[model samples]
Target: MSPNPWWQDRVVYQIYPRSFCDSDGDGIGDLRGITSKLDHLQALGVGVVWLSPIYRSPNDDNGYDISDYREIMPEFGTMADFDEMLAAMHARGLRLVMDLVVNHSSDEHPWFQAARTSRDHPLHDHYIWREPGPDGAPPTNWEAAFNGSAWEWNEPTGEYYLHMFSRKQPDLNWENPALRQEIWALMRFWLDKGVDGFRMDVINMISKPWRADGSLPDAPVVREGFLQPAFAMVCNGPRLGEFLQEMRREVLDHHDTLTVGEAPLATIAQGIELTHARGGALDMLFQFEHMDLDSVGGHVNGKWALKPLDLRDLKQTMNRWQQALHGQGWNSLYLSNHDQPRPVSRFGDDGRWRVESAKMLATWLHLHQGTPYVYQGEELGMGNVAFDDIHDYRDIETLNHHRVATTERGQDPAEVMASIHAKGRDNARTPMPWSAGPKAGFTTGEPWLRLHPDHDSVNAQRARADPDSVFHHYRRLIELRRQHPIIVHGRFDLVLAEHPLIYAWTRTLGDERWLVACNFSGDTPVFECPAELAGREARLVIGNLRAGAGERVDDLQALVLRPWEAVVLRLLD
Candidate 1:
């Protein structure tokens, strides 16, 4: 069998610099801290480490709003530290994927600072700007991703600057040819520094495709304030492909680097086209459809309310993306990230069966035909942290949503606060539970962020000793994927013959075929398969339970799948 694509077969581990580990006893994780944990990550069987932004930032968005593209954040480390970290990672046979936040820069960035100096400044045109209305309000009805108007009033320029996110982050004017070339040069700078690739943050938001009159694309459902005409006008603009191609030629094409874009508003077709490995712009793009399952109403553009995800919709969405992007682009499979809450609390029964359900989720994601990414603390089955008050939140997005859900949306403040508690970045931002000691051994001093109260009980040390813990299960799952080529490069066909709760799929390559059946419900679900479909006897490859190999004594028989149980069986001739 042909070896799979490098990234398709590899697993990535995400590191949030602030919470990873602190070497200086400063209560914040840094480059040295990450280097120290490289062994831990290597032991986890992860081929790559996807780091959150360590670029110089004002920390308004915790490094998302970048102030410098070249330098490391002082709090994280210096140039020397970054160099050493990269070298150390390479030495350990681990690839490093740096976070790229080029769509917008912090207002404090030299370019933006110069632009704000005077309207006649050469850099003044680097960012999108427009005159405000007679009411001294924003230029448009567009909303910021962090809340409030997308346009931020600039007193110096006497114009409102556009920021798709926070006011501190002004969107760059990619329409300028000079700006595009400059950004391309910056990308090469990192590649030259021995970095593997980039995780482009909000890469889709770089373009501005606004018409002269600022009218959005005249579509019937294209309402105001959601996806402005400017968004389409800007995103994937006139020269997006060209710029990406140039970057590929100069930066990515030469090296075995990976580029995964945080494409939020892109459709499945658009995502596939943009990430085609043959000649596409990026290596992969994350689709938010599955992540948005908890969103209420069909209106995908407004303040979201938590809703139960139907098994049918969830299975269908995953199947669609897997099938459509088969040969074109790859997939970046993840259930949790810094922007999301812990998956166990949100999806699994964290209260009763945390480890079993966590393993179930891991099997469900890792066995799929895509590269799996494990966020920090995910392997240990971390759950959501409790936040008694709004002041406990440090994320700009959560704070902004709190305002909209309460004041503008006229919802009860208590309910809004409760939702934030249930679905907040702070949940994921809590310190990693390294041990059972105070502060979970993350820091001797008070941590930059609070540790989860349950850290004492649920920690890495305890999980490491327990063979049946989620951590060990993850290790076994990764080994299974790495050892079997079919798991990575095989054809994925969803088995919808059974109930939606019984999410089963088959992967096959040549004579090698495997069936992965998962029961998502609490009650045991029987998965029925036809004798002809089985082709031959099937032996158990991996199961979340303690069942041994070749226990499959059935073709049209009942299989007892306990709560959140998953099984991967190898078809034997």
Candidate 2:
């Protein structure tokens, strides 16, 4: 394998189409709206743009439940708009990677629609199906990610079909060779249309737990009255490696495309098998170990049990991936996505030091040893939205959790709202703040989802105009990765690991050693350089504070950082 792939040095920016911009002003973001903003991405210095699903869907999971593989969702625009968007991206030298949601298809999809008709239907095997118990009960105690039983009763067929998510989305049966071919053909269709690659949604869940008797097994109940997450029964199943490798061989191998899968509970060792550079299944994998640091109790209770972000635990988790995947596999560095809360609100201060903490967090993630991903509005420092009323949220996951928690578990409504405020996916689904103008400049009419409450203060116009805004900071970080090979291919070693208020690390590429430090709290923290960088000449690559953006000669041992400050210095011999 070559030392540096093109993807390794470039940054990937994600855009949830519904929240980006509304071109038609019908209250939803569309494909043309994305085409209009190609300049924003080119200006941001991201090489690749990862678009969330714009495929035909019932929107049960906010486009995660795909209904048609060949057509665009009418709310998003037509196929012509998609073609225009892709061409516009390429014209600006930007590559577009579409979200591929093959783990499940909407029940409205033709295949599933036909499959549910009867057991004798030709497409009956297209989706997983099973007979109910003797008394006509659900197949197992497994729970849907959105709530209720994993198996939904199909009256026409007199059987239950598997749906790990919403019942509207039935899990596709990869066990059927014909169904696998159908998926590959759809992938080829997009590739032929000039798409650069795919960001596979929950690709690990394509295969389910199967017993020797050819039946899906039930997961032991962990929470007494509640159904288990069934994570063990759903993710990284036995045939996962075979399926991924086959995918690479059949379709991905033919094109120079970026392939990344959403791996929910994948360990570092397993992550290597799926992404090893030579003879590996994928170019990279988005692992969720680090994302779990601040939470416990998986989706059975909507994972609403919130915990404070522990910097040390984060430090350990990140460094583990860094060391483990250094050469064996690859890593995709991201702090937040459409499925997670806004980074600033979750990890940094969204109240007093929004800008400073936003930059700090970006600096921390981008300087790591992998390709970095930037979620929409992250550069503008948009924090999470705290919708006081549950009616405002459009996310199925958040809505389901709120409903089940308040009614079934008898949890307090206010407490449930607090959890939603902290970890709800709706926080990331809010419309992007393009301007301080009315409607946040996202739409001309009522927005499909609510806009950020502070859009007036935190908009792209405000950020781009300010030299010290988080937007410019992110741009400069991307510039650094492009210009300096060390930032992309360096070895990582964490420093000040025990420091509660500071998260600092060193990166080395041959003789090039750099010190990257971040103050993770609201209080000022003093960070000392590692022994090797104690007296080295300091050249500032980037920093959050305006005064520290250029060359510096401060003593490394007593360097003082302001609240939520971050800096990266190239130590010269």
Candidate 3:
């Protein structure tokens, strides 16, 4: 409604610390490494950098299980290094957004240690603790996101602690006002230290109160092959809005900072209510509906079919969000993040035609109506890493799922492995392909993890030299979005929704109108332009191939598109 907000025009880059760059030659990425790369990030036109968890941790969940929220992890350097990184980022006109994992804390944290020491201790109430059932088993049938039961037996306390994730990371008791205040104080500390904002980790899950009665307030939905119904009950609870609003009032709203919640399960209605401009809660939230586009089913453990999306479905999904949040909230749009597989490998053709297909995918998504987020190595058209051995894995969730499907669930190991092959963390977490050198130039040693073998051919060094590479295409895309006001503030409208392979939309802001069309299928698709968009002259702004200028499809005329080809047109009155 108003002029596009600063965030809408900016490109946010996600950096997973461990695999980004190793400064000290220890095979682990650190703050100094990120500081050293500020110029490269700035050159790419990134306005904000979202760093994954770098807080003090046991590395059980690779920094997600924070032991100390106030301190940086030793492996990632000290708080001083972080401060220096922040200053350097500011010098480059880039903002730093740190991960805030308030939903849980590492078991080794002082609060958890004190809680385990004595039942009467003041810190004992900081985390969720419930009495065991009559059979001395877990209090409820709630399942952990990784695998089996959510509750872990605590012998010292003679009770079970709630861990929606790994056992080493216990969920905090947000129902306790004192604990909530402490979290607020931590937020204030970070903001005082010059953090632009926070990328809230599982921020919605922090709302659930531990009920000793083992009965969730809302009924659970148990779909076929779907195990975690507790996710629905715990995520986005009744008190979620209240908690987020308090957070905004105490920390984010004060500085007018950017706060994007990692709220994958939140509905569009909930997102609008929480992120509306009138200081509802967050600036935006990441939804996984489109991110999970190629999956075989909605279930995480199922095999991925690599199915190309029906253009109509993609258009409807985007239209639903755009229409819902038109004037109320904002959007954080992305194709690849740390937890998911690489976009090019899963969505685009990454074999012989990697560069072309990758660029096409970039054009189709980044030019849409939302703030763009580029995960590390996405610029290089990086694909999923292939691993033949179990030792090649570094992610805890992947390992746990492997064990569950093969051991407990009694499924064929090959079939389980096939699912993992299609979708695995190694897809997004492989070492950044900096150059065609030892360790893909990510490290001098044997790397903390396996580097994708294709790094030799798909490194940034080569992409930077090629004008047609996906990396350069991203640069052009960012520049175009940054310079165009209408693309940022314009209203989104779906133009053609009946075709299964042709997705077309238009953006209108004042006198400027731009039409974007894409072919989601591998075969060429055609669509007839609506009468409302019929015009005598429309110039081709951009396309997958150099179709040249002055190409116009008048209203009522059918336009044909090659497989995976996308185009943008400028309407001239």
Local distance difference test scores for all models: 0.81, 0.88, 0.80
lDDT of 2 by residue, 221-325 (tens): 666775558655789988889998888889988898888899988889888888888888888999988888788664444457888878998999998999999
Candidate 2: how many backbone clashes? Answer: 0
lDDT of 2 at 323: 92
lDDT of 2 at 485: 87
- Candidate 2 is scored at a TM of 0.97
lDDT of 2: 0.88
TM per candidate comes to 0.94, 0.97, 0.94
- lDDT (Cα) of model 1: 0.81
| CA RMSD of each candidate after superposition | 2.6, 1.5, 2.4
Please list the residue runs of candidate 1 whose C-alpha ends up more than 4 Å from where it truly belongs after superposition: 1-4, 212-238, 298-303, 530-536, 548-552
Between candidates 1 and 2, the TM-score winner: 2
lDDT of 1 by residue, 161-211 (tens): 988788999999877778777787887888889888899987877766667
Ten consecutive residues with minimal summed lDDT in candidate 1?
Answer: 216-225
Lowest summed-lDDT stretch of 10 residues in model 3?
298-307
Cα miss at 264, model 3 (Å)? 2.6
